[model samples]
Target: MKFKKQIFGFMDMLRFKKLVPNRREALANGPADPLPTEYRTNVLAHRLHPGRMEVELVDAVMVTPTIRKLTFRRTDADAFPFFRAGQYVSLQSPVGDSLVSRPYSIASSPREALENKLVLGVEDAGFFSGYLCRDAKPGDRFVMSEPSGEFHYETLRDKKHIVCIAGGSGITPFVSMAKSMAEGDEPYEMTLFYGARTAQQLAFRDELDALSAKGLKVVYVLSDETCDGCEHGFVSAALMEKYVDIRESSFFLCGPQAMYDFVLKELAPYDLPRKAVRKDAGSCGNREVSDPRTFRLTVHVRDKVCEISAQENETLLTAMERAGIDAPNKCRAGGCGYCHSKWVRGEYVVADGRDGRREADRKFGFIHPCVTYPASDIELIVPVGE
Candidate 1:
């Protein structure tokens, strides 16, 4: 045993002594080329997550009486970042004394986004949307946030078949989803139920017609007027069940509160799982107050401080935009937490069901300015705008 231990120890010593020479030899034989200046992973990361970008409006056409289809191209790059079909981007621009932005779902396919094109169907309803539909001209530039939101289909979480119920301008994301399916970029069967007040109010009819020929299922439901192919009524579960199996498919509803309430009630008897239904979170606008009170808002952005007047009914984001503060925000519905700020001191009310802050954010007094309305004078520290 002693002799065997001595031999093994000698062999180990010899192996340990050769480590330095072996390493030196390996190093000498290695390639002497300098490290790469750019890595593919980093390049891919930059491509996928550009944060924000400047975009130029290339074309604007009236898709319906109130909805305008606006096309955009990235001014900084050749193509916009490819995103999920149903995602939305917030476009911001200076409108007179105020900087305004709104989230619009992508109407074009992700493949079109890679070809230097993106599209939004903006209804002529809101302040900024009115500008886009009426006053804004081609070549006008705006800042666009990255595509985001949890409204897109997840293969693992959602069923293979999706039932998309769209109302008014809510047809935007479904249009993209249908186009994505037609383009073979996404793998899912989509059955879109587009609802409008009248057949004349339906947007994207011609495009949807062409896609229908390509095997994409589209049903036009008009409430006021009847057409040869359209079903004249609200898109209730009875109307949907006529075409597809609701039990074997997931539901995607994008529309006003009334439409959501109606559709949800219609499907309540089905007793579907929570994950089986998804809804788009539209931005929270001003609350309805009988007489809104004005309160002073002190905001700190980096080293700069500004004083703005906030209304009891309006959100902090609205106040900052009214003062041209350019506060950072993406999904202004409070779900994205992009406009999260340090609440130093304030009396505010978060919009009902709009408080989406995490436990850490709540414990640390961080508030999403987009959904918070000031009840008294407030002081906050906000991040720089994207």
Candidate 2:
């Protein structure tokens, strides 16, 4: 019995020795060559996920007043990168002393990215839109990210037909999809329900009309001025039913916050699955109404508690910026967790629809300072950026 036990022990030792070589090899490789420290930090902490991108600025003539398009081309000499349709790219720039990043959806066919070109449309909004409209020229260079967003027409998930309800600037992505359909770049039949205040504000009208002439169904739902060829009403279920068959079709909505809120109520009548409907990003409806009650916000950065005035209805990041307290933020809408911070003690209300807090972060008392407003005076721990 003792001799048998010794033989079993010897076999166990041999098996352990056989497993050690693979473990040693993995350790020697050391985590797949560790990306540059800056790149790693951005991915984990700053949300600056890096991708090999080609960046160039190309002119896109509107041929109309308020609607202009800009095209970006790949600078890579080898091959251009590809991106999914309805995805967005982050453009980073210095807004005064603070660095800011904004995400814009690609309004070109998915194949365009492979051709070293991706397009985005901007309306008359004075922020980035105004800059793109008035200042962006052919030779100008704009920084951008690889396509990012979940608002694409998926074959496995979405139905055969799609009724894209677009309003104002929200018409961008649909234009790309429509162009793709016309060019046979994508395999889906799309019916666009476009809403505008007037015919003058309707973007890509001629291009859409041409696409429709080739069998792509395009309908303009104008809110003002009943024209001969346009429907005069906001996009609702009844309106959509009049044009496209919505029984098994999906509804893709993109517009201003007020328009989306009203459209969601209008769409509530349709008992379609939750996956059948989608919306895009926009400004948080919580306007900055200054409150008289001001509290001091003590932020611990690099082991120093820097005090700043926490204004009512103002975000902590905004307060810190005003106080010359430099911090990192990419998407100020709170969707990007770049400005995530630990709230030591305080109450805050992140605007509805803008809150993208992870479940674990909520459980652990972490908050995104971009969209979080001061419900009470508080202290927080934040990371300093170089």
User: Among all windows of ten consecutive residues in candidate 2, which has the lowest summed lDDT?
Assistant: 43-52
- Judging by TM-score against the true structure, name the best candidate: 1
- Pick the lDDT winner: 1
How does candidate 2 score on lDDT? Answer: 0.74
lDDT per residue, candidate 1, 1-386, as tens digits?
Answer: 99999999999999999999999999999999999999999988888888898999999999899999999999998888889999999999999899998899999999998998999999999899999999988999999988888899899999999999999999999999999999998889989999999988999999999999876899999898888999989998889989999999999999988999999999999999999999998889999999899999999999998988999999999999989988999898999989999999979999999999999999999999999999999999999875
On residues 90-154, what C-alpha lDDT tens digit does candidate 2 reach at each position?
Answer: 66544455444456667877676667677778775655566677776787665565566677888
| CA lDDT, every model vs. true structure | 0.93, 0.74
Q: Which residue runs does candidate 2 get wrong by more than 4 Å?
A: 1-49, 52-56, 60-64, 74-80, 136-138, 182-185, 213-215, 285-310, 317-332, 336-338, 376-386
**Each candidate's TM vs. the true structure?**
0.93, 0.75
Q: Any residue pairs clashing in model 2, and if so which?
A: 88-148
